[model samples]
Target: MAYEFTKEDLKEIEKLKTKYPEVTPVTLPALWIAQNRFGHVNPEVQKLVAKTLDLPEAHVHGVATFYTQYYKEEKGKHVLDVCTCLSCQLCGGYDILNYLEDKLGIKKGETTDDGMFTLNEVECLGACGYAPMLQVTNDKYVNHLTEEKVDNLIESLKNGEQPEYEKIGMPRRNNIK
Candidate 1:
């Protein structure tokens, strides 16, 4: 089936567009809407976004590729982006990452067989003080991680529980007036 935005998604896009003088500035929000609705911003989704924004496909694709937050292909329900920056590294971030890999039985950048989790070793999540942190689906950050905590997190996620996390840094500006 051909990809298309839902009515509500279109409405949200329109609402977001109102914040900008022209559609070009709406690219990020539009791509975000597509990713949130469809999971990942695939080529087809990029094309649709390009069409919606009246921009070239390459332009949309470039914008999506420029940001690590935008997944270009299908990802698991939960994506764990572990911080491997200097601060996190000093705090044993790699150990936590390796532990996750061993526990999940999937290497970094690969999804589990059941498609529940995907692991990624990402750059700084801006939680230098917290260190050893991971972000789940841009929703929350798991900070001051321990192996036991990682185990519990995996189990909780496997059980469909929204585990509470100790957020690390200041909130990102996702909503612009």
Candidate 2:
């Protein structure tokens, strides 16, 4: 597949290159743009980026695999990533993951058949206060999640509604009134 950069993407990539001085310096941003544009960093993109920056395909793949944020394979519209660090695990993280697995009928690292959602488990999302948190797309749902809440969140997305983040079972910050 031949992947051509969009006009806007080219402009942004040029800006990134000017700011970074070296093409390697903008590797992350460039990879992000490619992922956002093509939904995944297919082999075609790897080749194009390598050619653009005069780097090798192996080098480009190295950076892409290093970051967990980038997806190499095609993903559904929504990606649900559960935090499975020690903190989250200790705070009902397993149950939360189990619930999502059961609810979505998909195992970890798998996408649903309907092509609406993908379920994955990742390391800490830096929201330890909300131990059992999960990120859907760009938004994070904090606290120990219950099946009902997860179902509600999924339904809301199905209905084309953005889920509002409201603290539920997670510990609150201090200095509150």
Candidate 3:
């Protein structure tokens, strides 16, 4: 089926466009809006975003593909992005990744059959000081991980629980002003 944005999405995009002088600059935010609503940026959604912003489809494709944050395919309910940077690697990041794979029965970049979780080995999550950390669905960070903690986290999530996690890095600057 051909994807199209909702009326509410269009309104949000219009508001976002006002922040920038040109429509081209709204590409990233528009793409983010699509991802936020759809959980991923598939080809149909990419085309929708491109048309909405009046940019070429190829440009949208390039921007989406260039960034790891943009998922071109469908993702699971909870996206687990494990940090594999140098600091994290030295602190048992690979071990944690392997453990998650074994526990979830899916390899990195693959979603579980139940669609509960997707694993991704991502670069620096900006919490190098707190090695062995991961981001959950771009919302929360779990740090100083271990097998026991992983088991507990999975069980909690399976029970439809939103477990609270500590933030590992400094706060991000979402606005210039």
Candidate 4:
């Protein structure tokens, strides 16, 4: 409880502790909140969480690094994740990723000079039909891309134009369809 966390955060931590009788049960959620606040897991955060829970920093680091969702460094506002799964590769995901790199002048795991975009290669995004896809933020996944399409997608994103994704999967509902 003597961590560098804010007052509100401490309250939330107290609630979590109340909910979970064990310290280990609260580790993942606490790490997620800490990372959201700091943009990444750092040595300071690991130590703070570990000491607060009477755990080891190395254990905390192991959990943080094991998950791809936990970023290790500061990321750009928009994360461009290119699919590199087998389906996507067969459909030219590699070329699409190369195009993104060349266009942004940054390789995979690198951010743009303007801090607007970060390029990364990820596993299947569940859009195999739209293989060779790139996800911008959590919204857009421009698929079946050509060079012109990629350029257009980037420009539209820069212009704050949110494209509609039709002809793909539907959102799940509790009730039957």
RMSD of each: 6.1, 3.0, 5.5, 5.0
**Candidate 3 regions with alpha-carbon error over 4 angstroms:** 167-177
Q: Which ten residues in a row have the lowest lDDT in candidate 1?
A: 163-172
lDDT of 2 by residue, 1-177 (tens): 678989898899888888875778777788888988988887778777777777788989999888888888889888888988999999877788889899889999999999898989989888887778788864656456777878888898888787787745645889998
Decide which is better by TM-score, 1 or 2.
1
lDDT of 3 by residue, 1-177 (tens): 667788999999999989987888899999999999888898889999999999999999999999888899999999999999999999999999999999999999999999999999999999888889898887788888899988988898889886695754676898968
Clashing pairs in 3: none
lDDT of 3 at 32: 93
Runs of candidate 4 exceeding 4 Å displacement: 1-3, 137-149, 156-167, 170-177
| Candidate 1 residue pairs in backbone clash | none
Error of 2 at 103 (Å): 1.0
Highest lDDT scorer:
1
**Candidate 4 or 3, higher lDDT:** 3
lDDT of each: 0.92, 0.82, 0.91, 0.81
The deviation in Å at residue 175 for candidate 3 is 34
How many angstroms is residue 75 displaced in model 1 relative to the true structure, after the best TM-score fit?
0.4
- Which regions in candidate 1 have their CA more than 4 angstroms from the true location? 165-177
Q: Which candidate do you rate higher for lDDT, 1 or 3? A: 1
- Give model 3's TM-score versus the native structure: 0.90
Q: lDDT per residue, candidate 1, 34-91, as tens digits?
A: 9998999989999999998889999999999999999999999999999999999999
TM-score of each: 0.91, 0.87, 0.90, 0.75
